[model samples]
Target: MGATTVLGLARRAAVGVAGAMGLTWVVRAAWGIPSAMGASVSAIAPVAVASARYRNRQFHNTEPSTQVAPGSAVSLLLSALTRQGVGRPLGAIPLATPEVPERAGALAVTWYGHASVLVEVDGYRILTDPVWSERVSPSPVVGPARLHPAPAPLSELPPVHAIVISHDHYDHLDRETVRELVRSQDAPFVVPIGIGAHLRKWRVPERRIVELDWGASYCLTGTGPGADDLVITCTEARHFSGRGLIRNTTLWASWVIAGPTRRVYFGGDTGYTTAFAAIGATSGPFDLTLLPIGAYDVHWPDVHMNPEEAVRAHADVCGGEPGYGLLVPIHWATFNLAFHGWSEPVQRLVTAAKAAGTTVAVPLPGQRIDVNALSPQVPWWEDVRRQ
Candidate 1:
C-alpha cells in the first residue's frame, strides 16, 4: 500500500475506536443518572417543608455548620493532590465472616466497615448505613472505591427488622444497596424526613419507607417472644446532605435504637454537637454507641468527627458519663475518604477513650461483638498498618 493509503486507513480506525468509546460512556451515564440525582426538589419539598428544621427551602442544622471551613478550599484541593497513600492500610484489611444467629441476640453488633453495621437488640436486628457498593459514587467507574471488599454479600445478611439511613450522601445511602435490600428483605427503611423521596424514586415500596424528623420515633414490633417493641428514633447530628450539586434538600441525623431491654445508638456520621447531650437525657445511657471516627479533617471541622470528638460524643450520648457505653468506631477502615493514616482514627480513639475511662471494641470488618461479653482491646490495626 502507498503511504497516503496507509495513513487514511489509520485515521479511519482511530475514528471507529473513538465512536465506540463515546457510546460506552453514554450507556454508563444513562444507567446511573436516575439513581444518582435522586428525587427532584418538587417531590421532596412537600415532606421537607413541614419539618421545623426545614426553612428557606432546605434543611438546616440546629447549630450553624460549615461543610468546608472558610478559605480552606484551596488548601483542601492541594491536600487532595499531594497526600498519597496515607488513607490506605499497608496490608490487606482483615475480614471476618459474621456469626449471625438464627434468632437475633439480646444485644450485639457486627461492623461491616465504613458505617455499615448490623445491630441486634432484644431479638430484633437493625442494619445501619449499609453500603455494599464498590464505589460510593453515582458512576460505578469513578469515585472513591472501596479499600477492601465488603466482608459479606448482601444476600448473606440475615433477615433484618429495619434498614436505617443517616443521610442521603453517597457513602451512607447507596443506590445499588437499597435496590438489592428491597429485593432480599421485607424490612422498612427508617430514615430522616426528606429521604423518603429518594427511596420512592428508587421504587422502594411506600409501606417500607419510614421517614422521621429529629426527635420523631418509629416503633417496630417483631415476631417471637421478647421482640415486642423496638423503637427507632431520629435524633440530631451536625452534618449536611446531598447526592448531587444541590445540598441539604434532605436531612441528616443520628439514630436511637431502643429495644425493651437493650438500647443502642448509631451515629451515622456527624461532627460533635451539643444535641447529643439532650438525646442522652431523653433516650440514652445506651448499652452501645457506634460513632463515626473517620473521614474527619481540620478543614471541615463542623461536619465529620475526629477521633477525640467521637469520644466526647459517645459520652454525651451516654448520659454525660465518659464510661457509660461500649464505643465501637465506624466510618474509617473500608474507604479512604480522608487524609489521615489508615489506622490513625482507631489509635487516637483508643487513647482518647482510655483517657475518658470509656470502654471500646475495635472489631475486624464483619466481626460480631456481643455487648454483654465484651472482649479486651486487640491492636489489630497496628499489624495491618505496619505491614
Candidate 2:
C-alpha cells in the first residue's frame, strides 16, 4: 500500500479509539451523576434552615472552624505531590473474619475498617457510617480508593437494629451501600437533620429515616429481649458536610448509642471540639467509644482529629476520665485520605492512650471484640509497615 493510504487507515483507527474512550467516559459520568451529588440544596433546605445551628443559609459549628487553614493551599498541593508512599501500607493490611454472634452481646464492637463499625449494646446492634464502597468519592472512576478490601460484605452483617450516619460526605454516606442496606436490612437510618433528604432522594422510605439535630435521641424498639431500650442520639461534632460543591447543607455529628445497660459512642468523623464535654456530661460515661484517628492534617485541623487529639476527645466524651471506656480507633488503615504515614495514626494513638491511662483495642479490620473481655495488645500494623 502507498504511504498516504496506510496513513489514512491509521488516522481512522485513532479516531475510532478516541470516540470509544469518550463514549465510555460519558457513560460512566452519567451513571454516577444522579446520586453522586446527593440531594439538591432545595430538597435539603427546609429541614436545615430550621435548626438553631443553621445561619446565613448554612450550618455552622458552635465554635468557629475553617475547613482548610488559610494560606496553606499551595503548600498542601505541593506536599500531596511529594508524599506519595507515605500514606500507603508497604504490605497487605491483614483482615479478620468478624465473629458476629447470633445474638448481639452486651457490649461489643466489630471494626470493619475506616468509619464502618458494628456496635452491640445490651443485645441491640447498631451499624455506624457503613461504607462498603471501594472508593470514597462521588465518582467510582476518580477518588481515593480503598487500600484494603472491606472486612466483610454488607450481606454478611447480622441484622442490625439501626444504621446511623455521621454526615453526607461520600465516605460516610455512600449511595450504593445505602441502597444495598435498604434491600437487605429493615433497620432505620438515624442520621443528622438534612441527611434524610439525601436518603429520601435515594428512595429510602420516610418511615425508615429518623433524622435528628444535635442532642436529639431516637429510641429504637426491637422485638427481642434488651432491645426495646436502645436509644440512638445525634450528638455534636466539629466537621463540615457536603457531597458536592455546596457545603454544609447537611449537618455532621458524632453519635451516642445507649441501651438498657450499656452505652457506646460512635465518633463518625470530627476534630477535637469542646462540645464533647457537654455530650459527656449529659449522655456519657460510656462503655465503648469509636473515634476517628486518621486522615488528619495540619492544613485542616478544625475538621479531622490527630492521634493525640482523638485520645483527648475520647476522654472528653467519657466524662473527663481518660480511662473511663474502651477506645477503638476508626477512620484509619483503610483509605489514604491524607499525607501521614500509613501506620502513624495507630502508633501515635497507642502512645497517647498509654500516657492517658486509656484502655484501647486496636482490632484488625473486621475483628469483633467483646468490651467485657480484655485482650493483650497486638502490633499487627507493625508487620505491614515493616514490609
Candidate 3:
C-alpha cells in the first residue's frame, strides 16, 4: 500500500475511536451504575401490573380524580431534562451555631435538607427519612440532583438512638445512606411494615430493626441500665411509595414521638386531606411539627401539599391554633425534585404562617433549633431566591 493511503486509514481509525468514547460517556451518565436487578427486580417488575390491578380500588377510595394526565407527565419529564425555565441557582445558606445546645425535655431539630431531619427529644436523638445521596433518582448521574449540599456529613452526626424510615422511595429510603447509617451508628432501624424487607435486603440485621404498621407504636425502653422508654407511633399519611418502577407496595407514614414532657410530630410527606385534623384530635396539640413543604405540583395535589395546605396541616396538628409551640418546615431546599423555583416553597409558607399567627423558625440547613429558643430570626431564604 502507498504511504499516503496508510496515513489516511490511520486518521479514519482515530475519528471512529473518538466518536465511540463520546457516546459511552453519555450513556453512562444517563443510566446509573448497574446493580443486581434481582433485589429490586422482585419488587420492580410487579409495579405496573400491581398499579393496573389496584387502579379501580385505589380510585374508589381516593379523592376525586386529579391524577396527572399522560401528556402533562411527558411535558414535565421533558422540562426537567432540559432544565428549561429553571431560575437562578440558589447557593447554600450558612448556619452559625457556636455549639450544639443540650436540651433535656426540649426538642431539637437539625434539617439535613429535604425530608431528612435529626430530632433530639427527651434525651434521645432520632433521625428520620435520611437521604444523603447525591441524587434522588435510582441513577447517580441523571435525575434531580441535590440543590444544596448536606448541612453535615452523616458520619459527623451525634449518636442516634434510632433511624426511622417513612417509606421505600429513592428520596426517602436511600440504600447508600441506609448502609452508611448502619455502619456509622448503632441505632435500631424503625420502619413501616414492608420497608423492613428493603432494609433486610440491604444486609441490616433483623435484631436491630423494628417494623410497624399504621397506628402501631414502638417503645424504646432503656437499651442499657439508665434509659427511658420513649414511644414512637406510626401515624397514617395520604401518600404513595416506590423506589424503582413500582409504587405503594410499602406503606408511607408520619410519626408521633411522645415523651413524658414533650410530644412532637414528624409529617414525612402527605397531600391535603382531612386526616390531619383527625390526627390532631386523637394524638396531638403537639409541641412541635416537622412538616414537608416542597416538591409539589398541581398534577399530584392529593399526594403532596403545597405551601398553603401545609399551613392548614400545621393548624390541624396544633388544634386550629397556629400559635402553639414551634413550626419548623422540612422537605424543601434539599433536592430539586420539582420544577418550581428552588425557594418558592419557603417563600409562600412564610406569608401563610404569618397571616395565620403561627410562630415559625426557619433555621439554616445545618443549624439546630431548641424549639424553646426558636432563635436565629429573619427570613434568610428570602434573600437567596430574590437573587
Best model per lDDT: 1
lDDT of 3 by residue, 305-357 (tens): 89889888989988786588677888887776667887788888989988988
The TM-score of candidate 2 is 0.97
Ranked candidates, highest TM-score first: 2, 1, 3
Ranking by lDDT: 1, 2, 3
- Model 1 bad stretches (over 4 Å): none
How many residue-pair clashes does candidate 3 contain?
0
What C-alpha lDDT values do all the predictions have?
0.91, 0.91, 0.75
Estimate the TM-score of every prediction.
0.96, 0.97, 0.86
lDDT of 2 by residue, 289-337 (tens): 9999999998999999999999998898889875799999999999989
Candidate 2: segments with Cα more than 4 A from true spot: 1-3, 222-228
Candidate 2 shows a clash count of 0
What is candidate 1's lDDT per residue for 1-387, written digit by digit as tens?
999999999999999999999999878756776667699888999999989999888999999899999999889998989885689889999888999888889999999989999999988899999999999888887789899899999999999989999999999999899999999999999999999999999999999999999989999976665448889999999999988888999999999999888899999999999998999899989999999999999899999999999899889888987578799999998888888999999999999988999999999998999998988877889899888
